[model samples]
Structures are given as structure tokens and as C-alpha cells.
Target: MTRTGSGHPRHSRPGDGQDSRRRRPPPKGRSPRRRRRPPVARTATANGLPSGPRGHWFLVAAGLLVVAAALTLDGYATGVVGETRPGPPAGFASAESAEVRRGGPVVNVTGDRPTSVRLPGRTVALTFNDGPDPEWTPQVLDVLARHGAKATFFVVGSKVARHPDLARRIVAEGHELGNHTYSHADLTAVPGWRLRLESSLTQRALAGATGLHTTLARPPHSPAPPAVTDLQWAAMKELAAEGHLVVLTDLDAEDWSRPGTAEIVASSLPAGGEGAVVTMRDSGGDRRQTVEALDLVLERLKGEDYRAVTVTEAIGMPSAHRRAGAVDRFFGAALNLAQRASETFTGVLRWALFIAGALTLGRFGFFIVLAGVHAHRTRGGTRRRNAVGGWPSPPPVTVIVPAYNEAAGIQATLRSLVATSYRGELEILVVDDGSTDGTANLAAAPGFPGVRVIRRPNGGKPAALNTGIAQASHELLIMVDGDTVFERATIGRLVRRFADPAIGAVSGNTKVGNRRGAIGRWQHIEYVIGFNLDRRAFELLDCMATVPGAVGAFRRSALVALGGVSGDTLAEDTDLTMALCRAGWRVVYEENAVAWTEAPASLGELWRQRYRWCYGTLQAMWKHRRAVVERNPFGRRCLGYLTLFHVLLPLLAPVVDLMAIYAIAVDDPLPVVAAWAGFVLVQGLIGWYALLLDGERASALWILPLQQFVYRQLMYLVVIQSLATALLGVRLRWHGIRREGTFNEFTQAAGRSLPAGGPRRP
Candidate 1:
């Protein structure tokens, strides 16, 4: 087979690059060996940040923070902070003069000086506060309309925004509207800015709901003019400057306490049948008493020939409602839409949290049960050997090590291969894919005479793996990364699985070799708990998705039948494994075949690696999506599980964190904390079990709780970025992590002797 200039082998069909076997001749005049420029050195800032493309994790964090802050504020402003008591603050003193105290409930302080007026004789001003409620307000409105009476409704802006139809209804039914502040914030209790904001927001809500703004202001929890305190007077003056007439109630029905309807009606009646401004509530609690009392009060007043009217009507003042301007209407509509959207988003998040929690728990439980089944079924090699009628003769094997700037650990990889205890002919092939480092020279050094080094131009791991596959001399092949070191019996154990000819591929147990740092330990835990445990379940289900590149064994016939490796996705291993399964080949996990590989040492490196993996998996899933509808277990079991646990659940998992924060803000955090601790404990038990299965120290499970705070969030962000990239159709390249030669330390620590070689590079 001849390769193209791009290092990919030419195929017959465009979309069948991974399936076609008839390779074309090399392009005319293109030399088989071409010199390439040295790869660029990665630069870093003084602060040690990568001087490459910027990361978007900070942006993601900022977005989540903004959402949490909005939720917290919304909860607080919407009665979560609780209403101020219906009395002046302690130590408050009355500031009103005797004349003003004895005057009417309607007071205009916007003039050169404060002035007041009283309702006319036989006229009763019926005013309802903290209303425009969806339930009670309509009943109150119905009663007023039936009795031919018009009342003033002081509407909370938040409620009006939430139930705009009710606000519009209040105005449409010939009822007057008053500004009761956006959250019903007490004027005397809040700061000057908050007081202004509350009033302004209410005006906006009214304008959006009814295309009108109200100048009739009512301070929440305020008493009659006689009880107006100094601080209350100052707030009223500020409202006066903003063109508002403070309306106070002369008669307090106190229906908010749900007092007896008879008592409510008695309190509502004016003293000696004099004209009076009466206050009652249609919202803020059960207002059944207020509703009943309202009908009786109107009936009794009608019998007494005392007409019930609006505040403006009783005081002989102009209508408090004014038509809003275009600007106010536009902004008010926008504000209304935004508030509604925030509320809708919060509701969706709550449901998403519930679903994510359920899915997570279900997946954990399923994995534990199925993995246990796998362990029990394949508990011993004796059963497997007996089923195959005794182990077959060992066959010659080829080991392929694809290297790219892996000079740090390539020799150790070669030495580990040479030291394998397999009783068969073993051939080692190291394909150096245009590495700028002296990786090819290092592999071809005289210390290792059995190893063959194949040099090719840079074409990524898939292309290099194909080159190695084409060059190998044996039928059985084991593929391993240059940074991984296998135990002496690993290759033998991996090859033993081939005794069952039905098995086309075997995935070795890959462990984190450099588990000294926090990042390393986290990766180690993920490997044991996440990858290895899931592989156990996938194996039993016959829907194996990935034979990891760190270490895997395959028959050369399977490779040839599938056109070697495909460069169609960054996760070529996963892509090839899925393709093999779809082609009627079985892939299984061999936990006894252990290989140690280095993990990313920094968060940035880990993010890049996982981002590529996630994005590539998405690509492969889409590429093979047709299998989902085909008559195959790969579709029925593998795709469904990946879609749920890997893609959908991860996308919704962030909602759980956001809900936790919101709960802590508005409600008791003990439940949230307890829920989180319970989840972590479950995960800890699973991690400990995985470690026990893998023969690792359970002490490492201690870091699992802290992983939720940092490592888990990074993984979530990676998934988000990957999904965004896939949705936006952004093409991503395979990103490689820098090698740290950490696997060598693992080998040295295990007292494994290495083949003598030239001095190692620092």
C-alpha cells in the first residue's frame, strides 16, 4: 500500500477511507522521504500560563456565577427576605403635626410645603394593599364589580411582573392602581437607593402590564398619618420629590392576620359613619376573611348611603394613572420578559437537577451490579480455558509503539516490551511520527537490537498506527503508548485471551503510574472508578466502546478487515473498537494485563487532553450513529448508555451544583450539604471497591471528595466546551500532552531493571 502526500493512505472511496483496502500509488513527483521543519516550542508567560489559545473555563465560571447571583437576588427580592413588621422600627418618633395627623389619608408632599385633604362626607375610600394576586385579587375584584364599587390596589412589582395579566385586569376593570414597591420593600427600612429602585421597578411593571404608571404610592407596613414617624416622613419626602402622593389608611381592617370576618367588617367601618380611608389585604396570605369582610362592608355602607370609591375619587384628586411613554414601555416589556425567563430557567434547572441526580444514581447502581456479574462470571482463567478446550499454542506477536515527542519514555517502553515474559516470538516496532525530538534516533540506538524504528512524517496517531500496522511481521499485535510500561506478564496475559478465537481485541487495565501529585491522584481515581469499572460492565454487555491506546491487543486480521486505523476521529481507539464491534467482532477487558501510563501533571494539560477525548468521542458517536438503528448490540446497549451517562447526564450535572448554591442562599444548607455528603459517600464506596478489585491501596480514595470541587468541575467544563464546539461545527485537532518521563520513576520505584542505553535527556 502506498500513502498520500498528507501521510494518509489513499482509498478508493471518499467516505470509505477506513473501510477500503485498495490503496492508490503515491502522488507523482512526491518523494517517499521528505524533510520537515522542526516543531515549534511551546512558550509560556512569566506566570507560567501557556502562551497559546486562551482557555474558556474562566468565562464558564463567570457565567455560572452570574446565574447564581441572579437567582439569589431574585429569591431575596421575591419575599424570601421576609416582609418588615407592620410597625415603625424601635425608637421611632412621630414627626407629623397635629393638623396633618387629623387630616385625610391622601397627602401631597411635592408642593412648596406638605398639604393634606380629607375624603368628603359619606364617602369611603376602599384600598387594598400587597395585591394584584392571581387568586385572591380576582375574587376581591369580583366583589367590588358586583357591588358597583371601585377600589385602589397597591401592587407589588415582582408579583405584577409574574402575573401581568392580573395587573392588566386590575386596570381593565375600572380599578385604580398604586405603587407598592417592587418587592414590597418597606420604605423606612430600606436604603434610599433601594426605596427608589423598588418604586421604579413597580412603575415599570405597571407600565409593561397596563401601559400606565401610578403616582399613588403606599409604603408597605405603614400606619395611618397619625403614626408616621420621622424616618417614615423622610422617605415620604423623597417619594414626593419623585412626584408621588403618599396614601395612608385611616381605618385598619388588619385582615392580613385572617381575623374573623365579622371583626374585619367592624374595623373597616368608619368611626361615627365619617368618611375614611380603609386598608385591607388581598394578598400576602389567605385573604378569605378580607374578601368576605369587603362584601359585607360594601353592603353595609350602601345601606347607610355611604358610597365606596377609589382614593383619588374620595379625595377629589386627579386620576393617579398616567399613560407611559414609548421608552418606558419598551424597557418595561424587556424587563418583564427577562424576569419571566429567569423564572422559567430556574424551574427548568430544578427539574434538571432532579433528573441528573436520578441518572447519576442509576448509572452508579447499574455499574456496580453489572461489574459484579462480570467479575463473578470471569472470576478465574480456568473456566475460560476449559470452555475453549484448553489454551491454544502461543503465537508470534508484534508490539507497536507510536511516538510523537515521546523521547522521555520511549526507551523505557522498548525495555518493558523486551522484558515481557511471553513464551512466543515477539517483534517490536516503533513508529516515530515526525517527532522534533530525537525519538527515532533514541529508539534505533544500539542498546536494543530486536527493535525496528519506522520514521514517517507527522500525520497524527491514527496515521502512525496505520503505518506500524502495515509494517508489523506477526499476526498478533499489541499497541501501546510510548509513555506506558507494561508488567512482564502483561503481554502474555493479553495474548492468552486470543486462545478464544471469537475475541478480536482485548483492553488491558491501564493505571496511572505517576500518582504522586493531586492531579495524578485524581486521574488515578477516575481510572479505577470511572473507566475500569465501566469497562467491566461494558464487557459483559458486549458493547465495548474503547480499547484504550495506552495498551490493547488485536489480531492483525481484524485490523486488516477494518482498514487498519481511521483518522476520521481523534479517538481512533474508540472509533476502531466500535467499528470492530459493529463488524461482528468481540472486544473484552483483561484486568490481569496491567500497564502503567503517565497522566497529565497540570490542570491545563488535563483539560486539553480530556477536551479532545470528549470531542472526538462525540464525533465518533455521530459518525457511527447509523448503528443505533441497526440490528446490533453496539447500538442498543453502547450508544444508549453513552448518550445517557456520558453526554446527556454530564450536560445536566451542572444544574445540581447551581441548585446547591441557590439552596444555600435562600433555604437551609444542611439538606444540601447532607445530600452532597451522601453522594460523595456513595462514590467513595465505589472508588474503594474499584481499588480493591485493582489491587490498589484504598487510601487513595480519600481524595475522592475533594475531586468534586476541582477535578470534577474541570471535566464538566470540558464536556461543555466539547458540546459547544460540536454544536457550532468547529473543527478541532488532536492535542498532545507534553511528556514528563514520570513512568521511569514508577519503573525505578518498582525495582525493575532497564536495558543499558545512552544517557537519558533531562
Candidate 2:
């Protein structure tokens, strides 16, 4: 501490530690002031999120599982009604059972196990061994009376032989009695026939004394003396396979040492799971002490929420009719509960599916509406009427085309551009992104003039665009795909939208260049219905997510303000569009400005493109998540819409779809259908709306269902690869391989389609 003049300690300045003793001089060409770094931001806020109707797929999944479990339980109940259920106490040696079926075929095949099948409730088995002695049995009975606990006694038949009164009391007290054998000898050491004789004698004795037959048997411990062995397990299994479960101890109590009641209770497990078994050791114990401890253990475990039952009832293997009516009631209640669960799941799942389907279909509707608007606006002198309404004129345009291996379509795209009747001005900048083919020379060698070519190492499309933009001599930058060709008035339509000062970007229409094959045709319909309608609705909201890289124009100033085109992400166009809009820039769509691209000719090719697109979209969203919540200067806008469309839907839909598939595979499809039907219906509405909005003739409506059945469903498979790569952080780069020969291949797969032009049949 340093002292002030008043002798009071004061805090030192930040630089006061060690270097305070030295006098340092500033270096040459440096300012005298200490420089400060900008403050680091802790958290970014998302803003400009638009409201949207979206799906909650996770809830749908949990609901389905619940329903499935319920159905399984229900079906089991129905199966139990008339089927012959096995008795827990039946044995081959029992006199009455000697002529009856002692065990089923399965019991003989796989030895019975006393560990009963588990059910998902707090259920427990109460077993008492070496019992039926008069003194202990009566005392145990009184304690059970006090607390309402019932237990199954694995009786030493010899004890019952002496005290038939105690045996009768056990049965009268609503307890189950199973044979521990007459002599209490280890069945493991005895032959099967001898063991059978012992089991028979015990049963005969119990039946004579108590007038009840037992179904369950527990061996001495987790293992038995080699003779009695799993004969008990075998019996339990025999019972369980025939609709019964052999009760086994999941716990141990070691209470036979004459320990205090507190000690016995201390060893007890809290009642849950498949229930716990607390036992009296066979070797040593003051019978009275063991008996007394049983009372407290029962009380405490009951307090811990255990529902005690005799072995038969606990395992659903009751014989001698112990608590049969009550067991039936409990089983009935359980079935009812399962039915209710099934119904509830069906309700929730149906709604969730509806939402998903509806949202998707809605997007399609929006596309159609916008396309219709475009067609109507461009037709019947409407363009001339809106022409002079103070909308900015189409400025001189610079078109930057980045080519990697485009020897095929360079001439076609160039010819289309030269053929344009843009009233004002135009410029084409074809930056070759390090082409291995003759794409650049093809543009230069011919009468193709003014397509500025800047050759750069393989940096990607965004960097090439940036390079071209830097050398451009115009205020409007239109980046057309190297493989796409536009119509004569495409530029005019796109440029005219710039007249609205609020519009920062304008997206054009895109159609499949080739739609001959089944896959391509399906994609064609999907594009028309899903994309066109959606773009218009999005534009109206100023929440347009992606100004597709294929055909879009940007205000040069706005592009510059955003620090030029970025190559940091795969979906650079989407990233830039959202970034600009969130920053208060208005983005619109020009439906008349149509361009075409070669849709994948095969399912494999389509899958690859879609996979990459899905993955790229995710990367861009994550990279710019700051915009998810941060209120841009524009106000709260597309943020919510973007999350719903770009983040949440893709994140959740596949899970629901896949789980539904699994449910159908194992159980009934009713629940699965219930969960997803709402989604499908909503999808249909969207399809219809899209076609309606696009001004598409109802004649083309047939494609709507075809798209839904074929194209829309592809999202499941595509999302799988996207999700895997995102999770595993795999980088994917797809440089489409150019076919070996044919200029027809150029128009078909490499170049853009002219508006309403005959499709190139790839």
C-alpha cells in the first residue's frame, strides 16, 4: 500500500506495479498518448426476427413413444383375458399336479429364472423363507396385520408337517406358500427325480395344511447348493412364459443375526425399479429378532412408497386365488391408463405433423403468389405504367461470372447476355476462379466482348465475385451463374426494382434448365411451387432469407458497406442477404427476371447438391447467429422467420420422420400417421397456394402432389448427411465434374435457361 500525504493508504494507478521506477521514452514515429483497444463485447443480441408458424418435432416424438408403450401394454392385456396363465407353485412332484401340466415347453427348454419380468411401476415382492413354525408364523402374521403387508413363505414342508395350524394361518392371512422342499436339502446335489420328489412332498404337505397351491419358488440365494439349483428358476420361468413371472430378490437384508430393527431397516433399499428383496439369512438368527425386524423394515419401505404383495401377485403368477379380484382391478386400471396415453399421443402428434406440413406448404404458396404477381405486372403494359413511378432506372450493370471448369457453357451464357435489351447500360465481369478447363479463353477468343476476366487461384465463388466487384465500373452488381443464361429483359426487370430506395437487393426467378427425367421433372415442379411463391411472400415482408447465388443484383454501396463479398462460408449469398436485411436494407424479388440451372440428372447427383446446400446453410446460420437476436438497425424483422425456416425446421424434422418410420416398423402405424397427418395437410395447402399465386394454370396442378410425394420428402435424406457433417465437422467441397463432350451438355447441365424457353433435356 502506498500512503497519501495524509498518511492514509490509497489505491495505485494501473501501471504502478514494478515499472514505475523506470522512466521510459516513446519510440520514433509514435504518438505520446497511450493507445487503447476497443472494448470486447460479451454477448450479441439477435434482432429483426420475423414471426412465423413453425413445428415442434421433439414433442411429437415423445408423444409417439408414449403411445407405442401404451399399445404394447394394451395388447398384452387383451392377450391375457382367456389365455391359460401359469401357476407360480405348480411342480411335477405335487400330487395333484402330477397328472397336470407342471411346466410349459419353454420352461423345459430354458430353465426357469426366479427373476421375474420387469414392469415399469413401483412394484415389490415380499418373500419370507424357512417359515411356517407356529411361534414365528403367528407373530409374523400379527405384524403383517398391523401394517397390511403380505409375503410369500418358501416353507420347509417338514415344519408344516409338524405345525399344520401355522401353515393354515399363512394361507388364511392371504399369503402365498411355495415349496422350499420337504427336507430342505440342496436340490443341486440331488438327481432331478429325487429333487422332483422333494418338491412334490412339500407341495402335498402345503396343500393338505393350507388348502392352497403355490406357484413361485426361490432358491437359497443368488446361487443354490448345486441340487435345488435353478430348479426354482426353471419353475419361475415356466410360470412366467405362460403369463407369469417368478419373483426374485433384488436385495439382501441379512436380518437373521438377531440384529436390531433399526439395523434391518437400515439395510433396506428405497422402493423403486423392479423392487428390492430383503431376506433373513439361512445360517444364523434368533427367530424372534428376525421376526421383530421384519415389522420396522416393512413400515419404512412402505413409507418409501412400496406396494407390498405376495410373490404370486407381485409377479402376476397367483395361485390359490390370493387377492385375485384386486389383481384384476389393478391390471384393468393399468390398461385403461395405457389407452388414455395412446389417445393423447395421437392428438399431439397429429397437430405437430400438421404444423410442419403446413409451414412448408405455406412457403410454396408464397412463391406462387409472387410469380403470379410478376407475370401479371410484366404483362399488359403494367411494366410501362410502373416504369416511371420514381423507381430507379436500371443502372449500368456489371455481371461477374466465376468459372472453375466451364468450357461447356461460357459461349451460351455470353450470347444470352449480349442478346439482352437492357435500356440503360450493362457490364459483364467473368472472373475465372482458377479454371482447369478452357472457360476463360472461350470467353476471350470469340466476339464475346467486355466480359472482364480476372484469373485467381481456386478461392471459391465469393472471392471471385469480390475480385470482379473491385474492378467493376458500375453501381449495380449482378452476379449471374457461369452456367446460367438469362432472358432479353431479365436485366431490365431486376434493375427497375432498384427504383425503390428501400430495396437493397433484388432476387430473380430460377427454373430448372433440364426437366426430362423423372427426377428432374419432379425438381422442376418443386422449384416452381416451393421457391417462386415463397420468394414473393418473403420479399413482401422484407424477410427474404437467400438472394439465390444464381441470379441476384445488389446495390454496390450496400455490398461495399458490408465489407465486400465474403468467402468465409459455403452459403455466402444467404449470409450476405440476411446480414444486409438485418442491417435495415430492403430486399425484393423480380419474378420476371428468370434464369435457369441444370437440375441434377440423377437422384445421386440431386442428393449431392442438396446435401451440400443443407450443410452450407447450417454453417452460415451458425456463423452469423449474432443476427439471430441482435436488433439490427432495421428493427425486429426476419430473425424469428429465419430461425424457424433455416435453423429449427432442419434441426428437428428428420428426427420426427425417422422415429415415425421406426414406430411403423415395430408397432402399429396409426400413431405415426396421427402425429404427421397435420403436417401433410398443411403441406398440401401450401402447394395449392403456391400454384395459385404463381398464376400457374391449374393444368400444372398435377405436379404439386408429385412434388410433395417426391421432392419434399427428400429433405429427410438430405438432412441426414447435413446433420452428420455438421455434427462431425466434415468439410465438403463439390466442384461439379464437366462431362467429356457435347455442346448440348452445355445448355442442358452447364448454362441457365431463358424465361419460358424450351427446357434442355439433359
Candidate 3:
């Protein structure tokens, strides 16, 4: 569990750390077998002034997928997914050299104003907002009238126009008018023209209500664009020339959430009480609590004999330590970002990882919906009875099943291929990888006829796949692992996408074949959400990085052009996808084409599989760094996606993690708890979508908290171990994935690279 002193994946047998069998076995109903997998190492501006908001969730998904791919990259890879920034610049040459320098002590208020004001008699101020509500505004006014208290009402233009009577009632009821803009949109998104529009419309709406003569405005959502306050202040000056003032808020009831009356009372009423806030929200929907809270504040203030008055009454404000501290904290953050950007290029990579992952996922969502729409328009679908024998013929296809000591799975895989729905001119090739098991003999038996067996010394998986691809007679090459099986229509659907000619490869959605165990179920979620959905986004981005090796179709021309997969990278499939992209070919992802493949059913197997993948990714990125600066469209697109999302940002993810842990474990309670809660909330929001996409809606809520321990910590370990080896150039001796014995066989860890997964040749 402790860090193994930061080295490349330890090239020892699974038992070397502690037992015997390297892999666990395949699932139930399948023969016992061991197989090996090759080891590989690896948003948004709601913009102001933009004509449209565009993107939505599809673009967001694209960004997530790109980051996910960068996650696959080995730490050594450059550009987006790999390490790009140095951790905070170490104690800069001088604090003066900082890019974002700290300014003077945080100012509390521009002018002296009293923290409190008292008059000889009792004094109090009342606030209302988001009014012009036909249902609630009048009731609020009536209550104020009964209490004989003067109040202020903040109104939005649209609502004022809709219910002018309500606005007039407030004025008639002795309440002052305040501006709250026109459309009620978040003001953070309003700037320049819209900024002016906000003030203009509010005045117009107010003119319609009572008078065009008044002045005052409160931003919607307490959100103001850059310099919004200053701009408003300047406008206020012009209005003041005619005698008017602008008001800002210090007290908030958070009434927008409709906290019940009691909760509202608790939040708004001060310890001693009588309260004054320049702004508030409409409270009638559920304001019994708010009303109760107001009464409570009134009681306390009356008891304490303190006075609450308008800004005009308070002459000198209290000390500003808290507000100053906030500015100081902002300064610290700016410093931290600057420092980190210098050390290893963390900013660029973090940005890359975030951008790439998001784009990848967003694009996937887009295509899924797009394809769905396209299908609906064409009267094409998985459920419409297939109009006879599935869609139109998709040329001929050669199904290749690569096997090494895969006796347990060999027959099953061959059988599955033979049973496929595209019964026309189909060929099955089982390239045997010098199986110690009698995998070859079983293939020669009578039950399988059209299946051909080609035996070769095990150089590696790429070698096996290359041999099969070479002997294939058809241009449409389908690759399915011996331990995997396709749904009846998977083959036909996958091949059909190639009709576009531009698509050189089409990935089949791979699901977990074994779902009985907890480990397997966890992996099931990973595959559906993390892998398949991610690919959809990747395809949409034109950077479908890896057409999964588990089950996919590739154009034979594209396959041959890439020189039949090289041993240069552990993940030849991923490497091939990149090469194909570089070769100007596109890879498409088909969610309907599902192939169920066996997951490593155990933790040890899973780590090794992931280690190889990470290592291979790093190797791939290193091989292709030239794409970053290259002018080719594919090169530019891939590089931008990689550098911004994968390389810089994620390498620093552990930084974010450690900082979070640091924030949580601190001695003080407030900041730590705040950090913990914020982190969890953000992650939960994201996890909700990921789980919803993965079809584990029930688990999403629970999964967020659990991830911090199980998934998060484990991820840090993977990153550390992967990085050490990657940066140090340590080589992984493990040859590739060796299957486990039957899922029920219960074999222990054995050989160096080969796990127990491969079926022993019977």
C-alpha cells in the first residue's frame, strides 16, 4: 500500500509482492482459461456579448472525454494530457516579480461609515425583492402596512410590466422603489450593451409602474460583470446630479431557495437583532419562516434597544478585517496558480486535461443524440424489426479472434462469431499465440467449420492481430478478443458506419461480460460511463483516440497503412487509432454495437491492466508530440485537445487532491469544512451526470462520497506509480495481459507478466 519508492510498474510476478497465480479465471459458463492483455503505459464561458450560448451538455461531455483520454496518457506524454507545468514557482526571485501582485491592505469601505446608527427613538429598515409577484407582493405590503413600517421593494422590469398593479400597490403602501434589472438573468453574463440595457429597462418598467423620475438598481442574482459596480456607480453619479442613489446589499436571507419560515427566521435574524439589508428576494411561496425570522429579529432588536437604519444614517463603518482577509485569500490563490504554472507547466496540462476530457465527453453526447435523431429521420433503428435481414449489406467482414493459451474461450468465441447475424460471406480467424494449452487442436475439431486456425510464436498481441489481419480475405476487418462476444446485431451495425468512407474505424460498445462479483460490477460501471460514453465524445471531436481493441472494426487499408500494429507501444490499439487519425482517417463510435468483454475481475489484475494502458499512452503521446506545433488540421486538433486537457492539468490533479486533503485535515474547522463540502458538492454534481450516463442512477448519490476513499486514493496511487516510472524511463517487463482461469477456477497469481486469465489449451 505504501508507495513502492516511486518506480515504474514493478516488473515482478503477481505473487512476487506476496502468491502464485497471475490472473483470475473467466466468468461462469465459460471454460477455464488464462489470457494476457498488453501492458501500456499511459469548459465554459457563459459569455457576455456572445450572440448565442451554444454547446450545452454535449460540448461539456466532449471536454470530459478529452481529459479522460489524457488520463490514459502516461505522465511522460507532452502537450495536453501529460505533465506540462511545474508545481508553483519555488519562492519567486522576489515577491515583486509575481504576475498577479497583491495590492494594498483589503479595504473595508471606500468612506467612513458607522457600523451602527441610533436615533433617540426606535429605528428599523425593511427590505423586499423580486416583487411584482401578483400572488405574494400585495400580501407582503399589507403586512408592512399593518406593522406601520416603511420598506423597500426591489423589482425586475419584466415582472413590473406583467403586474404593474403589484408594483403600484407597493408604492401606494408607502414602500420605496429599487431597480433589479429587466430580464432577471444572472448579471455576471451581462456586460457592455446589456449592462446599459439592464438599467434602461428597469427605469422604463418603473416609469410604467409609478414614475420615470426615480433611480436605484440591484443586480440580478447578486451577480455583476467586471466593473459592473463601478459602471453602476458612475451612472449613479449622473443620476445623483439629478439627486438619486444606488443601493447594494450586505444582509441576505437566501430567500430564493424558499427556506421554510423557521429556517428563514434563524438565518436572517441577528443575535441581538433589528436587521437592515439593502436587498432580499420574494418570500411568499414559503415565507412563514421568513416572517417568523423577521419577528424574531424585531424582538431581539427591541430587547437590545439597537437601531437599524438606511445607508444614509450609518456614518462610520466597522473595522474590515473579514473583508480584507477575503482579498488576501484571493491574492494567495493568484500566487499559487502563478507558482505552479512555472515549475512543470501544470496550467497548460491541467487546462488540457479539463478541456480535452470535457470536449471528448461533450462530443460523445452530441453524436449519440445526433445519431439518434438521424436514425429517427431515416426510419432506421435497433428496434424497428430491422426491415428484414438488418440494414443493407456491408460488404464482407473478416472476424479475427486472437488467442494465446485461450482454450477455455477459443470455442466459445468461434461459436459466437459463427452465430453472428451477418450470415453472408463471413470468415472467422483465430490466431493462436503459441498456446501452451491445446487451443489449436480444439479449433481443428468438427463443431466449427468456417473457422480457421493460424498458429504462431507469441511475439505479443500486435503480432497475433497482425497475422490474422494479413490472412483475412475481406477489407472490413473486425477484431474481437477471444474472451469477448458480440450481440447478434453488433457486427452489422458496426460495419454499416463504414459506408461513409471517411470513417476508417468503428468502435463497438464493450460491456462487462462478468457481472456477478463486486469488482466486476464496479468495472461494469467504468466501461459504460467511462469508456463507451467517453468514446462518443472523442469521435465527435475527431480525436477518437483509441478504437478499443476489445471489439471494433477497421478498414483493411487503414490497418495495412499503419504497418500492422507495432510493439513500440504496449497499447497497440490506442497507438493504431492515433496513427490512423494522423493518416487522415476518421474513427466513429457506435453505441448500439455492443460487445461484452470480460473485465479483470480482481484488483491486482485491474491495476496491471491499467498500468500498461497508462504506460502505453505516455509512449503514444511522446511519439506524437510533434502534432502540437504541426499545422495539419488533424495534428492541430489532436495536439490542442491533448495539451490543454491531458498534459498540463491532470498531472496537477494530485495537487488539487493533496490540497483538498490538506484543507480538510487542518486544525481549524471553518475553511476545512467549507473546502470539503464544496469539493464534494462539485464532484457530486459531476458524478450525477457520469452515473446517469452510465445507467447507475441509483449508485450516483452514494458513489460520490465513496469515491473520495476508494476511487480517489487509489487514483493518486496509480498516478504516482505511473509517473515515477514514466519520468524515470523505467521499462515494464510484463509482456501482456494473460487471462485468469475460469471465473470459478480460482487460480492464484503466477507468471511475471502472464496472469491466470488465459484458457489452458485443452
Error of 3 at 176 (Å): 55
lDDT at position 24, candidate 3 = 67
RMSD of each: 6.5, 18.8, 21.5
Q: What's the lDDT for all of these models? A: 0.79, 0.58, 0.55
> Quick one: ranking by TM-score, best first?
1, 2, 3
Off by over 4 Å in 2: 1-394, 633-639, 651-685, 695-713, 737-762
What local lDDT score does residue 145 receive in model 2, on the 0 to 100 scale?
A: 79
Shift of residue 42 alpha carbon in model 2, Å: 29
For model 1, residues 54-96, the per-residue Cα lDDT tens digits are: 4555666777776775676467457654345455354444445
lDDT of 3 by residue, 562-613 (tens): 7887656656777777788888888877766776666666666667666566
Per-candidate TM vs. native?
0.85, 0.55, 0.49
The superposed Cα distance between candidate 1 and the true structure at residue 546, in angstroms, equals 1.1
Task: For candidate 1, give the lDDT of residue 686.
Answer: 89
* Number of clashing pairs per prediction, in order: 0, 58, 118
